[model samples]
Target: MTTTPEILRYAAFTDLPTGGNPAGVVLDASGLDDAAMQRIAAEVDFAETAFVTGRDGDAYALRYFSPIAEVPFCGHATVATAVALAERSATGALRFATPVGPIEIVTTRGADGITAAFTSVDTDLAEFDAPTLERTLDLLGLDAGALSSVLPPRLAFAGNWHPVLVVDDARAFDGFAFDPAEARAFMDEQGWPATITVLHPIASADAGGPRRFEARNVFPVGRIAEDPATGSAAAAVGGYLRAIGAVVPPALVVIEQGRHVGRPGELVVEIPPSGGITVSGRAVPIPDDVG
Candidate 1:
């Protein structure tokens, strides 16, 4: 008899099934080595893939791998994996022991299925020097004016390090373009693990309520030109918002991404009064098999 690994695909951040970031999940990757896991992730060809091994009570030990390498943490993939587990077990709270640290996830079952949300580790922000920022902009083919003064240039981290460059509006985001090779080269020079550039409009009052913000993420280090939905980046943004005092305590913000890729994703970020950030979304299974 032969054994096979179960590979499941789930789109995080969207309940509509069509919209969200797609992640590969291996619920039981007990015997796989690092190289094997990397190969599996590469074969799946999603931005990130998650592999799980042990579970202690409600907590499980998990690892994340990109198509090219292993990442310390991945927020969207975490949410996807949790929801996948909830569908099998029962919808409720689960814990994940990741490379970064232990994370808590809560799941709920609706008419559609189980939806999961994960709270990120404590976040921090740092300032980058001028030369590095200039070099980065040069590689991105963007001028200093293209950057938004409101957000400024900062290195933000929740689990992984991402240099966040915020732009003024959707037009700027839509108009911006860059060579992947050049961007990668700049990141290599700057010693940045990953670089994410986001463009957002100022908050506006609407008839319904406060309008949800629209944004796009450009990820060059993962060998991806752009990510459909980026929960890690969203967590970093939430931390940034808190650091800058943009939003008061106990605020909920919506981040819209992947619209340009035709796979629109929505991420809801909640900031607690005490601390930490919670990112919530849905995951849909992808039909595939792995071992």
Candidate 2:
């Protein structure tokens, strides 16, 4: 008898199928080894793929793989996979024991769709050492003069590390363009620090409960040129803002990404007074043929 894991496709962060970042989910990867998982991820060819290896009483062992290699964690894939599990079980919370640590996921069914919220591991924010920032700006063809002084560049980590760079407006974020080959070389030289999160704050016209932000992730990484929405990056941004004291406590930050790439999506990041950041989004199944 031959056994094969069922690969599920889901787009996270958007109710509509046309938007959001697509992720590959393997619900039961108990028997798949490292090589097999890598092969599956490459075959799926999304920015990232998630595999579930074991299910304990309350926690599932989770692993994430990019097309190039394995990563410690991924947020959008967690949201997508959590919604898939929530559909089959009662409404409540599910926990995943990732390589980084255990992350709690809560799911709900609503008129819009099945939404999953995942609390990231405690974030560690750091300043990029010296010339790393300068090198990054050069690679992107950006000047330090164009960046916003209020929100300076910093390195943030939840499950993975992403450099948070803030510009004055959408115009600065939209103007960023880079060569994939040169970018790849830079990443390799700089030790492959996930994706660089470039962001611009969208001011609220009215008094605030929710703050809006626009972001783009260096146009491309891995095999994909653009990710419609990035949950891990959003989490990192939340951590960065909190560390920099740029955002008020107990705030809801709404992030927009992938607009220029055409697959627009939104991510809701909730920053509590303290502890891990919570990132929430809906995941819709993508048909095999259509994907």
Candidate 3:
């Protein structure tokens, strides 16, 4: 690389810098190549880092890289990038050309902070075969009985595919464990670099509000054992719920994650009748000391 890129640290999905998923953002990655971006991401040592490689008017081209590999899409990092851009520019609509497809994000500055919402690409779902389901359950230290009867085992895709495992009992959900190496190998085999998303239904904080869920994303391929907040996985969760008819159309789904890692955050998912799901959350700049 000719020069060092300016990397901004931001925590997505929460107002507090220390209370969300931290991601590295390179707003101007003009001269950086893939190798340089990957090296920078590794140096940053976050779960994911976003690079703005190209720009046209209000639209930008973005690439996401984890420490170990390139990812097609990363929700938290996208939010971080969007917020970073909004802070420098204006709060409004922005388009990102990603590996998967084009993503539309809207930034709004509120009293609390700068909140950015991105509508996911077209979503799809696939059920797990018997053998695959059995193997996954085994690796996760869970049995078929522990799974929620409401949401079956399936692969949900928003930008990337993720295994959606919803446990009926919250206790079982919290109690399940797995070997990261084994899980990572299995995920690699399945062509899923994304997290194995585990969700447990929880009571909504507001009466008669959106459906609430507590989430734990297992991804041991990188620096983190568990993601504090997984925006892409949360988007896939919205698709899974909508596809499975778990929630009514035009519903709102609330996902609370990161408490396990002590970085509690919330993601607001808006499900329309038939289209991309919108995941919204605020991002805050991470202090240099926290980096």
The number of the candidate with the highest TM-score is 3
Model 2, span 1-291: residue lDDT tens? 537789999888987666788999999999999999998999999888999999766799999998878888889999999998887777678999999899999999898778899999988898888699999998888888878988888988888888888888566678878888788778767664467788887865255547788888852556676567888889988888888887778878899888977778889999987789999989999986665
lDDT of 2: 0.85
Ranking of models by lDDT: 3, 2, 1
Clashing pairs in 2: none
lDDT of 3 at 148: 84
Off by over 4 Å in 3: 56-58, 204-207
Candidate 2 runs further than 4 Å off: 205-209, 219-222
lDDT of 1 by residue, 89-136 (tens): 899889999998899999999887777888989999898889888876
Report the C-alpha lDDT of model 3 over 147-223, residue by residue, as the tens digit. 88867889999999999998988778888888888988998998997899989988643668778999999888566
- The TM-score measured for candidate 1 stands at 0.91
Task: Select the stronger candidate by lDDT from 1 and 3.
Answer: 3
